[model samples]
Target chain A: MDGNGVSGAARHAAFAPLDDGGRAEVVARRLSEAIALGLLGDGEQLPSEAELAAQLNVATVTLREALSALRSDGLVQTRRGRGGGSFARSPADASLERLRRTLRELTVHELREIGDQHRAIAGTAALLAAERAASEDLRTLDTLVDQLAGAGEPGDRRRADGRFHIELAAAGQSSRLTRQEIALQAEIGELLWMPSGEAVPHPDAVAEHREILAAVRLGDGQRARVATERHIGRGIDQLIDFHLRLARA
Target chain B: MVSDVRAEEMSAAAREVGTALDEVFAWLAELAGRFAAMHASSVAEQNQLRAADLSQLRASIFPRLTGNPRLLAGTGVIVADDVLADQPHWLEWWQHAQGGTELEFLEVDHDPASVGFYDYESAAWFVVPRDTGDRVVVGPYVDYSGTDEYMLTLAHPVSHDARFLGVAAADIRADAFEALLLRAIGAVGQPAVLANEAGRVIASNTPSKIAGSLVHEAEFAGSPVRVVLNQDAEVRDCAGLPWRIAALRG
Candidate 1:
């Protein structure tokens, strides 16, 4: 189908206009976060200034100010000459301050709702994967579990964790599910792992992955679904705790 | 028997669809050949295809492509590594967004480490033709990183002087392409499905099994209803592509 409802909604959300009273800081933050989350894509040329400004529903001058801010933050680069345009550059670090502000603004209800959506997508994916995954899919899941275990850095760990879930959806053999999983990871993964400065990812993450894999390998669909939901449930609890702590600060 | 006539007519309809795809492939192959020829004759240092030189050809590509009934999302050639000295990875593609008036060049993440990197070489449309030296059509799947639309990609390999160069590929909107097939098979007046070798529905006249729905493998072999190019049958293939049409009992 050309523009299935969900896909069309995703596209619309991508270029949706800013809320009233949004400024250059708001624009820069949104673009940088998207770039950091890998939505904008590294080395991808952005739309022309006027087109982008119109799409974002911002004045061209405001957009230019935002673009300069992104440039200084190393999230974007502008080149001059023929075939030259602003390009995305995936920054290595996300702004914890911005993420903290975002989390603090959201109510506990919103946080739980996001977790519910995550569990719905992931739990169904794992259940179907248990029933339908090929032997090679099992192998790939096993390998991702190993990668998560071996990952030393928090960024590496976050990436490995996100990949495992995405691959889990892919193993279910539903492209629509796989895509939803990807978008969700970009939206929520970093936030879940945001408190990475002094903390290594919980070792239990790898163990939870193993448990999910074991269930999937044994074709226990219910067990797989429950395990995935449990994993996400724990993650959301921790995020809520972090949000509360931020509010107090 | 009535069953035999039904089977023959369905087969003919399948052939008609296959032949239409074949014509598209032939046109693509010729364009690839011309691009290869142009690259070979260039006097530039190392004979690399320069952007300035290729700009001339890009201007001509969109007009010729506009003639096709299929609403092409994009079409162009991907140059193999080292073929273009100026850029390491390049796809000289032009895309017209649905309902757009003019075609615009597509720019994608070429960096290997980027999450949105478009590795065309690994994609089926490019890989199948490069490996088999034959035309290949892939998808009815989403092109998430690039177009963000569901698409079917048809590609033909481009080779020069016995060395593989790259591929000339076209991305057609799956919805439009499916519409084309639905119109072509309208005369069958039965619930017919066009499916890939994996039993994944490419398109169907029925709403029950939409694109990406899986048809049971057993249906291909065990169904009494007529199937063109049934599993392991020596029946004429769908123009050398691994697809079949089945007219199920309504």
Candidate 2:
């Protein structure tokens, strides 16, 4: 929950000025990414348009345009008159039919490739994080792992899972790596970890995260890399099973 | 004292916009996941499937989804296949309309071997994701195929196992996006401009600073809202890509 340090690292790499044209799109895109990453909570009230525009160094007109785009996309809703400001809407669930369609598209091979890339980035990040992480960073990672373990819903668990990896990346102190981790999560994190019929068994994942954390705390890079890679490898297997079932269905 | 009040209002607007964007991306990610999933299945099931098969899948899947209603021109999907020749997917939604809506969904294909002018693979939307294997939102460029209008494409890569399938994407007309910008600024009560990362103005209340013009940094100095710009700028990242929102008062 206290992710100020991690979020700052993420924002450092995530936000950059637009060169020309598409200002609104850029504004809209950034906010959307933040929302997807769970950096912004559902139904969170936003700052005043004037204040936000100035903060972003964009024209108020441009900020508003971006907001309007979001509104059209059903991401934000506006109320009129007093207390009439835009608020974030909870994300819509992808229809089951759509999920089926999506499942049909993904293959076991691709899942493994995604898992492989995840292992490289996450393994390296964990190894580096172990070497560089402060006690505070370790504490945050522990808390996130705990959060994931306790999360009752798939969505909460998924977000916590994502934040744990991102925080690990931040601990490594590489904006590039942190950004890469964030992008990978944004791209395939949810789908790869999505829970089918019952909740995804979290005990193993929680234990794996703890093992990586323990190694990082002990400053054992080799142990951290091995643990992180194994953790991801296990996830990849679970996802493959999920996809296989979908294909067979 | 007046500047303080103005600053507060500007801050509130920025927060609102930020929150709104969060919602948009959340929705998009879900759609991308579904598309990627479906595309993956298609690739896995039929590795040797023709371009026509992909086209048929696109035609069936894209038209059914209820895209943004504010879209001036309707939305559709595109699948660029290197192996298959340029076989375009005609927009069935646009064709069967009752009213004389001045809209046309032209069929454009990206054929690597084509001698003609257009190359879809070269487009940023297609190339970026293909190279990175990440979802991409590209545009505000002239879409030669459908309506010859500036458009935004929300595209994701489709891969089966390790084999890359094709790009699954949706196009939203740029004018629709511009309209949204125009309305947002009109309500904010300030002379403002939205510029891309390259400093080209995308939208502006200042009529002189039209779209496509380089946004001079000095432009923020003379406006009533300049005090707002004096404060630290807020940076919003879009679609997990490098694109961002740097709002400046002018």
Candidate 2 chain A: worst 10 consecutive residues by lDDT?
A: A1-10
lDDT of 2 by residue, A97-199 (tens): 3443454477888877888898999999998787666555688799999998898665677778888988888776555577778778776666644433212
- Candidate 2 interface CA RMSD, Å: 17.5
Fnat measured on candidate 2: 0.00
B1-250, model 1: which lDDT tens digit per residue?
6667657656776876666566566667667877788787763346667655657667557775676635677888887776776777788888885566677888888888985677887777777767777666776655655675667788877888877778888887777777877865555566767776556677777886666555665554223232332334222122225677776544
- Runs in model 2 with CA error above 4 Å? A1-249, B1-31, B42-69, B72-77, B80-105, B109-117, B160-162, B221-250
Candidate 1's C-alpha runs over 4 A off are A1-98, A121-150, A163-180, A195-228, B43-47, B68-70, B184-190, B221-240, B248-250
In candidate 1, residue A53 scores what lDDT?
A: 84
Whole-structure CA lDDT of model 2: 0.57
The DockQ value obtained for model 2 is 0.01
The sequence of per-residue lDDT tens digits that candidate 1 reaches over residues A1-249 is 111222333333344588755588767755664453334556767779999888889999999999998898677899999999998776555575566567768778988998899999999999978876666568878988999999866556777899899888877766678889889889878776653321123578899999999999998999999999999888888667556544443
Clash count, predicted structure 1? 0
Q: Interface RMSD of every candidate?
A: 4.0, 17.5
Model 1 chain A worst lDDT run, 10 consecutive residues: A1-10
What TM-score, to 2 decimals, does candidate 1 have? 0.68
Give the top-scoring candidate (DockQ): 1
